[model samples]
Target: MMNRFICIPLCLFLLSVCNPKKNERPNGWYYITDRVEDSISLEPIVTINDFEEIKLDSAENLKGKFIYQITGHVAADCVEKWADATEHSIGKRIGFVFQDEVICTPCINCRIETGSFAISAQDTDIKSIYWQIVRKIHSR
Candidate 1:
């Protein structure tokens, strides 16, 4: 009887230890200024804590379409420069990568700025990718 009682508590402890909480930091992509020395180079501009909320949802009136939305405010300090960079970044690939092996690349066509942003890919499953991103980042 005592062994059974101890085993239950032990199992609970194991579960708690195994399922640790996720970090407060979020992992995702952002737009940044393009730099040039002799040649133009695309630089990933990071906005710290840019995402106030991230969510998964189905596209309205678009059957079988899924979207991931990020809502936040843009940097008020660099509006014009940010706008220019965003325009330059169109038709480019969007990514959030820590290393070569770990990354998420989403299709991007429009500018990234303040307010709400949504990402969806016709060639790839963004919902699946989004979940993978959440798991990969939250697991750390």
Candidate 2:
């Protein structure tokens, strides 16, 4: 009977150690401002934690096809940094990376100042990626 009681607590402890807690810090996700051929910058302009909130949703594109949108709200303290990066990156290619893997390299079309950013992708499964990112943002 004593062994059974000890085993129950031991199993619970093992489960807690093995499972990822919701509040745990997530792995690295980066915004790359520079890239050369297949290699991206080792220094990230911003990390996923810079965002206060991140969400995942689907929307219809001009072609009437459904696509995924991952929208983020820059933390107030990081708004200046985010704005400057976007402004300087206009008409230039930038990248989003997760765990050293390139997620997307899109050209910035304009300067964004609203403290919000949206990343939209077509012909890809963004749902999984979005969830991974959203799980990292504490305010999400």
Per-candidate total of colliding backbone pairs = 0, 0
Kindly list the per-residue Cα lDDT of model 1 for residues 46-130, writing each as its tens digit. Answer: 4323333446666554675455443333346644544565566687655553322224455457665554444554555556665
Top-scoring candidate (TM-score): 2
**What's the TM-score of every candidate structure?**
0.37, 0.63
The list of candidate 1 runs beyond 4 A from truth reads 1-42, 47-52, 60-115
- Please give the lDDT score at residue 60 for candidate 1: 54
C-alpha local distance difference test of each model: 0.49, 0.69
| Index of the highest-lDDT prediction | 2
Error of 1 at 116 (Å): 3.5
- Candidate 2: which stretches are off by over 4 Å? 1-39, 60-65
